[model samples]
Target: MFGAHTWRCGQRYDETMTLTLAPDVQHHAANAAGRDFVIGDLHGCVDALRYLLHKVGFDAAHDRLFSVGDLVDRGDQCEEALALLDKPWFYAVLGNHEDSLCAVAEGRLARHRWYAIGGGWAQGLSDHALATYAKRLRELPLVRVVGEGETRFNVLHAEFFGDDADLDAGRFDAEVRERMMWGRELAFNAARLPHYALSPTYCGHTPVRELRQIGSQTFIDTGAFIPEGRLTMVEALTSRQWSISVQAARAMGAAEMTLP
Candidate 1:
């Protein structure tokens, strides 16, 4: 339960605080239809996204694409990246970067803090564009769940710290919610693995040298913002993973600009 504080994303929480989680997949296409795929942190690299989508034969009319959030920042195409939110085939779970942006828009966080965290690209937006993006960011859920039977998958921005029994119960509160969006201890600390009842959780936020798997969780941020990094994607049902190198992406005209 949230303490006495103002709320922004529907649920009640302190405006000065942060949190995160979600489960429900009734909207995805059936197995007979196109596949469901998840992509890593996309920090404004729409070109890289386009290349990876092509490589995977992504059919926007059939296949579904889910982003692990951080879709805007540290790259040049933040405006272009927002196009995914309006696409019928695309879905996304909120990441900490998005949270920061939201906080800034809500006047809960300083513009400097957002700028400090690779959000300078937002300054280029028109008034309408900024409002549009802020509204969309506010509307994004903290989590997205898909699959059934024995292959259920939970997509969140960061780590899930709730008890396994609470996974499907939809009982995430403000504190746990913040952890899901910003927590790194569970994603990076190999020795502190907690047994999440939900198997095969896919998340990003804490960038890794590669897609890392600890227990039932998988971290796929892959540092796409770095020149040496690449955009990573995975077929949820088959566990077939693919990556598009930053250099390759640049060669394909995906690297017009970058952030440090």
Candidate 2:
């Protein structure tokens, strides 16, 4: 029932009747043919980031990427770091560093504390860039999301709420606080996420010797900022699958992105 036509080099076939594919598989194949990938964290490693994207064949023109958070501070490429993430297709959450920027600016935090944690990088920043990053950081939501394919994930620089304490009422300023300022407590404490009952959460901040999965949760931070430069990336279409980047390309993706 199919038809075929000989062309320049090969033959083009019309599979109107020749072959059949299940609806789900067909949909999966079609939708996931090429899609954007969401990455966990990047501490200003612009070259590594570019290498990773290049290796994965991620066409930035049509596809999109979502980063958990942390665009600057303590990294080798803070200026370049923010620039790389300035694209419309790229979406990210407000990271702890961003939070610190405001806190330090407002005098809520001591200058010593800020520098101790890499805030010194901002010293070289132009006033305009500083203002811009501050404005953007304030607008950043706590989460970055990828809600399609077999992979559905929520990314945060830190937790939605403190574990021992409750954002449900008063937690961060009242009961308990975490110095790391990432999402471990929130992931552990949140009762249930009706929307993500089937999906897993991907986060950074907690470095593991090896990337691991529990139930359906995923930990992606290997502390690339440290000497090892170990980082992990998961395919945007496949849930519960991850690859560690060696040349940075090892964690590559095969999709395109549409600027957000």
Candidate 3:
């Protein structure tokens, strides 16, 4: 973690211009002293998520869990993945996979396009479940800002575009919105990084062989969608980490079916 405290927009500014925090955003730490964990892209691996939580001794009634999103699609447990939205302690940012699912619901994208990109399991969802998941995804914010001062953590699905004004105002044009789901330049280009620096922002989109940390930005997507990959969960404040590989997940009988 960086020592210098990054400056963020004050809360007193005009309400209309500032993007409001996620509905679940903890204005004040829920436990103040309790643990909070952030998981990388899930991609419908509910069994792996469950095993990780069990391994961590997570207390759903107390501890909080934040996800980098892509909670659905690509895996066998898509239905169970959608159910996480109902968990009181769970919070998530919108990932590109969720973005595409939303687009499918709104008729902006063809169903086949979603399937081609590992969304075929959605076809198995009952109409009610599909609608319910869509509604839940609609409620998710593009960003989740947690803590304040040096402890401040920005949770987003992908890279943050350098737009303090638009973000502070809670307004994002099509480009900014698109970038949130698909941008990689910020992570791939070291020189383009400082321009967008802020409180440590945890994001997942570009899958890495392992966790990658550059300054305050941490990318934790370990390609859980691939059979050889693993699910990763990191305690936000403590930085305590836990992982469950695909083989381990299977050995634990985390899921009945294997990923494609």
lDDT of 3: 0.71
Using Cα atoms with residue i matched to residue i, what is each candidate's TM-score against the true structure?
0.84, 0.65, 0.82
Q: Which predicted model would earn the best TM-score?
A: 1
lDDT of 3 by residue, 100-173 (tens): 77667656677887798888988866656655566667678777877767666777877776633334455665
- The C-alpha lDDT values of all candidates are 0.72, 0.51, 0.71
TM-score of 2: 0.65
Question: What's the ranking of the predictions by TM-score, best on top?
Answer: 1, 3, 2
Among these predictions, the greatest lDDT belongs to: 1
Question: Once superposed on the true structure, which residue ranges of model 1 sit more than 4 Å away at CA?
Answer: 1-30, 126-128, 163-165, 253-260
For model 1, residues 1-260, the per-residue Cα lDDT tens digits are 11222234422223564543123222332445778889999998777887787777777777888888889889877777777788877888777777666667666777776788798998765556665567677667776767665656778887886644466665666677777777777865768665656757788988888888877778988877788888899988566998876668768765553211
Candidate 1 positional error at 153, Å = 1.1
Error of 2 at 120 (Å): 1.9
lDDT of 1 at 234: 91
Error of 3 at 211 (Å): 0.8
lDDT (10s digit) by residue, model 2, range 1-260 = 00111001101123453422111100011224356665656776555566556656777666666666666666676776677556866766556666666565544566567678777887766556665665445555444444543554555544442221122222233112232244354344435532224245555666665655543456666665665755555665465333444344334531232212
- For candidate 1, the lDDT comes to 0.72
